[model samples]
Target: MNNTVVVAIPATTANMGPGFDCLGMSLSLYNEIHMSLTPGFINIEIEGEGAEDIARDERNIVFCAAKRVFTEIGESCVGLSIKLINQIPASRGLGSSASAIVGGLVAANKLTGSRLSQERLLDLATEMEGHPDNVAPALLGGIIVSVFQEGKVHYLRVSPPEGLNAVVAIPEFHLSTHSAREVLPKQVSMKDAVFNLSRSALLVAALCQNRLEMLRVAGTDALHQPYRTKLIPGMNEVIEGALQAGALNVTLSGAGPTVIALTDGEKPAVNDAMKGAFQRAGVSCQVKNLKPTVEGARII
Candidate 1:
């Protein structure tokens, strides 16, 4: 048997339009975590993404997640060196933390003799991440629709349509998930609730069948984006620019400092337009032309 386990987990964009906490999809970018048993200690090393900002000690999220697994299974957590090769940007609303949680759990489970099934691993990952939207795709991959009900996760995975590309504009700043949620109203009007429900349903169905035309209407969200965009400067212009550049739909990726546009292969043009919009607004950003990935977290 292999003495080391490496888990490659994808980055995810959650809350796609009106789906709120229930919808998410995986991107091509990934974060990899490697683990090997040691004599008797816990050590964590990180590279890339949050290397300087993330903790190297037990306070690290990856270390904490791996430690949680041992505690959950009644085993002491020690004797492991976990290394994270992080690619997903932290606190950019791109599921960086979700990748870490899934990676840690999968690494621990693989080293512990695979005691949990994939579904169970997903549940554990969801528990650690506080929601299923991001972790669901990070662990299971593809476009995932998930709901946590009565302590169980129910989900459906859809393969992103062929010929579709994602143009992502990622800004340098960070947006805390807690801070983003803080601005949201505790109670929404019935009209707003119904608006979200219909849009969320349409977004899911249209994404599954590759109905590009439906996305324009389906992605009109009333739940979070309206409130969250207040935290993102020049957000409206960026969305309009992507639409003018031929994107089917543009939405905030997760709680967002990053925004993504769904396009029918005009990836580069859409990417440029988004960045230009931000630049015109005096904000600096990086852009990526990415495709959806079907593969989830796996040991290699």
Candidate 2:
């Protein structure tokens, strides 16, 4: 068997606009993990953005996924060393943990002679991720609509329309998904729930028909965003700026301080407007133009 395997998984933006935990798209940004079997104890390495203080041992997600796979198969092996080169920001709603989980599982699957099929790998990834939206798109690429039903995951892929670019405006602050969810109201008004459901359906229809104009209305959310916005200062300003600058739509980029705007023209204009809004609102932000990934996770 080959002693080493390297896997690359793309960053994902989930809950695009109004889909909540049901929609996601993969971005070009990636996290790469390399695994090699060695003699002694397990080891892990980290690099790039959030690596400065990340754990370098079994406590890491990569190591945890690898160990889960090994234990599941009842296989005992020599020590494993994992090198993680992360381009995705941690806890920024960019699927950083999803990438790690998928990358590690892919590495282990390859090293163990392909014990799992792609579907099986995805199931494992979804299990580790606690949600299918981000993991599905990260593992399969493109735009995905997913629902977890009766212990099974069902998903469909949709191609992004031409001239559509993802403008990610990342704020300097961090908002953990757990903390964000905690801030949401447990019960919503009937009117708000119906409003979100209607818009979410419209958003799906727009994506299906590649109707960029419809997104302006489709992206409206009454379920999560209204409640979550308080935790994300300047959220409304950024969205308004992106729309005013002619973006097709703008929404929370996950449970985020990072807002993603879908643009029909050159991304720079939208990015500039978004950054300016953040600045005017006294929040520091970085902007990046990301193309959708057609390819998902792959072994190298």
Candidate 3:
């Protein structure tokens, strides 16, 4: 048996449109973790993304998540050495932390004899992340529709349709999830609730049926984005720009400083439009044309 395990975890975009706290899709970007057992010490190496900000000590999220796995199985792993090669941007609504948590869990599971089922690992990952939106896709891949109830995650994965892609415009500044959530209200009107519910259902159905045109209406939101626009300068303008450039739909990617557009045609134009909107707002941004991935975290 191999003593060392390397796991690759994909980045994810959560809360696609009106499906707040439930919908997400895995992207082509990935973070890889290389782990090996040690005698009695924990060693961690971080590269790329938020390397300077990520902790090297046991306080690190990856180490904490991995430790949780060891404790969960009642197995004593003396120590571990983990190297993270990260490509996902942290605090950009791109599921960077989710990738880290899932990476650590999957790598440690493999190192410890692969005792846990995917469902069990997902429950653990959701417990750590406080929600299943991001972690679900990072762990299971493709597009995930998830719900967390009674301390467990219930989810289903949707395979993306061919020829569809995402044009993501990621701004330079970091927007912490905590800060983003703090800006939202505790209660909303019934009319707003119904609005979001209808759209969320439509979004899921449209994705499933490969009816791309329906996304224009399905991606409209009344729950989070309306309030979140204040936190993200020029967000509405960015959405309009993408729409004008032939995007099927546009929405905030998680609790974003990033904006994403869904398109089956003119991807480059949509990318440019999003970037230009951000620039006009005096916000520096980078754009990436990424495809949805069907594969999730796995030992490689």
Candidate 4:
């Protein structure tokens, strides 16, 4: 077995409008993990974003994932050293946790003589993640549609069109997925349920056809977003401002505080408008223009 391995996993935005835990796409942003076998104890080092307060010991997600893979492969415990270079922000609807999980597993797989196939690795990852949408796209890239069915996983990839750019506006505050999910109602009205179902299908069709105009209707969600929007103080204003500023569509990114706007151009105007809305709402935010990553997770 190799003594060392390095893996890079891209950050992902899941449930890009109405897909809600079933759709996602990888972005260019990444978190990198390097692992090497040592003699006695587990050691960790972290740098870049989300590093300052993150644990540098076994409690780290990378360590946990690596340990899990090693145990699954029947490998004896060796001292392990892990260095994480994080570029993705934690708990902001970007797949930071998924990156750590995928990175560690990929490194562990490479170190253990590649005993796990891609399917097995993804299965392990989804199990660890508790959901496959973000992890699947982060590992596979492009636009991914996934569903867990009959004790097996099924997925398909579609190419994103050239004219669209993803404009992500990230707020400074953190919104835990747990807290965000807690806001959702236990039961939804049949009309609302049907509304989301129709929009979700429309969203898929719009993306497949690169029909930017259709996104205005397709991105509307009556299920989770309405309940969760109150958690984000200026969510409605941000969405409205971005759309009015020429965004093709706007939606919450993952479990966000991070709002994503889809546009036909670079959409600096839309980004600025969204930022202004955040500022008016007394929240600080940063905006970046990101393109869909064609490749997902990879060892380097």
- RMSD, every candidate, angstroms: 1.1, 1.4, 1.0, 1.2
CA lDDT scores, all candidates in order: 0.88, 0.86, 0.91, 0.88
Alpha-carbon TM-score of each model against the true structure: 0.97, 0.96, 0.98, 0.97
- Tens digits of per-residue lDDT, candidate 1, 110-190, equal 888887788888888888788899999988889999989777799999998888788889998999999999989999999
TM-score winner between candidates 2 and 4: 4
Q: Write the per-residue lDDT of candidate 3 for residues 173-271, one digit (tens) a residue.
A: 999999999989999999999999999999999999999999999999988888889988889999999999999999999999899999995478898
lDDT of 4 by residue, 21-120 (tens): 8899898898998899887988899999888878888789988888888898888758789999998999999999999988888888888788888877
In model 1, which range of ten residues has the least summed lDDT? 37-46
Residue 186 local lDDT, model 4: 90
Backbone clashes counted, model 2: 0
In model 4, what is the error at residue 171, expressed in angstroms? Answer: 0.4
Q: Predictions ranked by lDDT, top down?
A: 3, 4, 1, 2
Clashing pairs in 1: 38-79, 41-79
Error of 1 at 30 (Å): 0.7
Model 2: per-residue lDDT, tens digit, 1-300? 687899999999998877888999999899999998876888888889689867887688888888777876788756798999999998888998888888888898788888878777777778888888898888899999888866567889998777778899998877899998998888889998788889888888898898989999998888788888888778898999889888989999889878999888576778889999899889998898998888899986
